[model samples]
Target: MSQEQHYTFGVSTRAAERLRSLAAVFAPSTEQLLGSLGKVEAGALDLGCGPGYTTELLQAQLSPAWTLGVDSSEHMLELARARCGPKLDFALHDVSRLPFPAPPAELVYARFLVTHLREPVQLLRAWSTLMQPAGRLVLEETAFMRSEHPAFQHYYAYLAQLQAHYGQNMLVGATLGTLCEAAGQHVLDAGVRVREIPAAQMAALHAANLPTWSQDPYARAAFDAAQLRQLGETLREIAAGAALAPAVSVGMGYVIATARPPALVQG
Candidate 1:
């Protein structure tokens, strides 16, 4: 990871729980992406694996002989190790650095990680080097997200600014397939996934996600703490009210990209 850019959502119990909740929400789509890949010859790695949720899903979906979850946060890794078994292991490393010493993985999977990097394409190129010939790289990222509530919209706008401030791309998912191609990977499947969460679920989702944002300096800088607190209260109130519930929906757009490293050229 670049010293200048940091993922503002620092590791915390609340953040960890929020990640696990998100993993659960996106599990089906992730499973679908993995299922589409068929089988693999070697190990699978979950890059930026938080709480090992996706790692577990990868094991279940692909049944790769070896599964490793890599994250920079030891706290998140602890949560992951607790949830996973011996078949699934955790590694502490900066994903951008790709410092782990191991054999090339047959599958490299990442969820919501690319947007945090300054040079996601370059990182993709580096990750491609960690793959065996024809190894698949699966990436999941948010293409776009919107909520029916104005407060949510207001929050996302600032979130986008914060990501920009950190030299990250909030909409990087939109161009991942092309980036994969630019990185000398062969794009096999690239598609968008649209999911609408009911008002209750949406409210719950934000409620879980808010804690990390609330405590984040970038979030506070983007929107004052008082406003974020009010938004939280509003989300709770919305969740509690039946009449207000069904009228609201949270729309999320995800891009799932699967690509393979170009076959090694024989000398």
Candidate 2:
């Protein structure tokens, strides 16, 4: 795996639970994006599928001939396989690399995946080569996040810094459309979907992720252990409703693009 693909949040059992909650929180927007595609006869590929919630969504929404969920972490793939039906298959592969184990897909979908990539435009170009001529490339990533709570704000700042250290961008969603165009794909649609998540829910998500990320070498070096502990406690309090805060507004940018014919690809 490339250094850029080193996910800061380790795939612990707690992280899997965090991902499940995250999938629930973001499902509506993801469903809306998939609905735009209607049905795909060829196949659908879910990149960085985590515990496979998004992969399940893809199957339900598109009912493609086949569905494959790929992730870099084998532990995540194991968790995904345990819950998924026979129709859904999970593969252990670094999504940032090319020549995936499966065949070319009719619809390639990734949610919160590109933010972890160093060369997102180049990866997009590689993905286009693995798609059918008319295949659609769908991406959903974080454009920005806003919260009134100091703990939440501080947590996001730390996350942004850590991702930057790994050559990734926490706010890569804002550039998805431009990246697609640069990759030689035809942009069909692109826009931001803003969602308001309850402070309690957001806190719970962060609390789950805290244990894993706070232990990272960079996080440990850059942040004080006592500060992280205090932040975790605050997040837990908010999650339990013992602390009150306003909802968090998150902006998710989505882009739907189609692979251009081989002749149309830029040199």
Q: Write the per-residue lDDT of candidate 2 for residues 136-206, one digit (tens) a residue.
A: 89999999889988999989998899889988899999889999999988898999989999999999988
Which residue runs of candidate 1 sit more than 4 Å off their true CA positions? Answer: 1-4, 240-267
Q: How close to the true structure is residue 160 of candidate 2, measured as C-alpha lDDT?
A: 94
- Kindly report which residue stretches of model 2 are placed more than 4 angstroms away from their true locations once superposed: 1-4, 261-267
Compute each candidate's TM-score over C-alphas. Answer: 0.88, 0.94
Worst 10 residues of 1 by lDDT: 248-257
Predicted structure 1, TM vs. truth: 0.88
Q: Encode model 1's per-residue lDDT on 91-123: one tens digit a residue.
A: 898887855655788888888888888877778
- The stretch of ten residues in a row with the least summed lDDT in candidate 2 is 258-267
